[model samples]
Target: MTSAASPHLTGGPETLVICGRVDADRAELTPRGELVHGCADILARALAGLPATVARVDLDMAGVHFMDTAGLQFLDVLADHGRRRSLTVTATNWNGQPRRILELAGLDTTDPLTGLAVTDPLAAAPPTAPASSAVALERAECLHVLQEEVEQLRQAIASRPVIDQARGILMATHGCTSDEAWHILRETSQLSNTKLRDVAAAVTASAEADGPPPSPELRTALHRAVARRRRGTGKAT
Candidate 1:
């Protein structure tokens, strides 16, 4: 999906691929550029037709390397257009400065990296109408992306409870700040050679069994956190 685009201002490589069109109204863009004043016009024009559809528009930002205020304003314009047109615009695969800027600006970056809008238009066709193989292939790809996203979300949610439980256990035992507790948990996980989540679950489980200790709170948090690790290795805890 990556290829050299036209020469940039510096006569260097700049690439942007917008694929996954469900219809004339919706599509996805994968951008790779030093988005600055030099390319702001091009970027704006590229973004202009993005919201032509009345429903969803997804954008994958994993390709964008850099973006400046001009580029930021261009995205703002795109978002405003989405609003005016009642379009559901979303972006994902964010990292680094782009992610920070989007967060600061309070933009939506939760669009799945797929396109499912490929069906509604074709739905009204006669029941006997043959489906386009190209559309079928695209839809299958979209479903695959959606499935991967669902699995990722499930893993994240599953991990959150144990992590939070471990954090709380640390806070209560160490009398430490949340950040400090997190650091302690992370450090302990590293030192004990246990996966962080497994260590956290162990901590919570141990706390549940023995209850919180009075004066030996720190020892308990650390000991219980690593004991399961030792026990798993056939070592006496």
Candidate 2:
């Protein structure tokens, strides 16, 4: 295995290992978090060295302790590039903050983590129907409306790498896939009775801070604090 303390570099099997901190200070600042320039550099290098017949790229994040919006954007760019190349890109060891970030971005998936042999979690759930004919159409309509709302929220935050980064962080932290990460975010938001955007924003902010992600218990407390503060002063307004 390659050392995880060096600059990001490409190795065998179309894999790229990004070691060390992503230098959040050097990244461009946005409402989300810092954006690392090094990510772009790494992506450019990785693309330049693409081998013929390469089907996927694996990004090992076990050693990465910190990243910002730019780093998240870099991953997004890499994912897009891989899609364009008709190649799949898998990000591993995406637990903790990194996994959470990716989950927010909607890029973390279990297929890669499970070596592509497992079934999709979202696809496994069966659809539900209304209990009576009187409200069957109404239930269907409600479900449709909910789906539309979800789609709208996704579209509204679609291009924001901060959201994606939060998703990634959750994926890593929970050992979940991208879809599972998203479900967790959504579920958390519902349980806490908070908006998805607010939850995502909080996750991004926590990841951007110094040090590793707080423990799950700490994370829950922080989320509650943030929510309470938002309610009290509307400071985030």
TM-score of each: 0.35, 0.32
Lowest lDDT 10-mer window, candidate 2?
24-33
Candidate maximizing TM-score: 1
Instruction: Write down the lDDT of every candidate, Cα atoms only.
Output: 0.55, 0.51
Write down the lDDT that model 2 would get. Answer: 0.51
Q: After superposing candidate 2 on the true structure, give the runs of residues whose Cα lies further than 4 Å from its correct spot.
A: 1-35, 103-237
Pick out the ten consecutive residues of candidate 1 with the lowest summed lDDT: 111-120
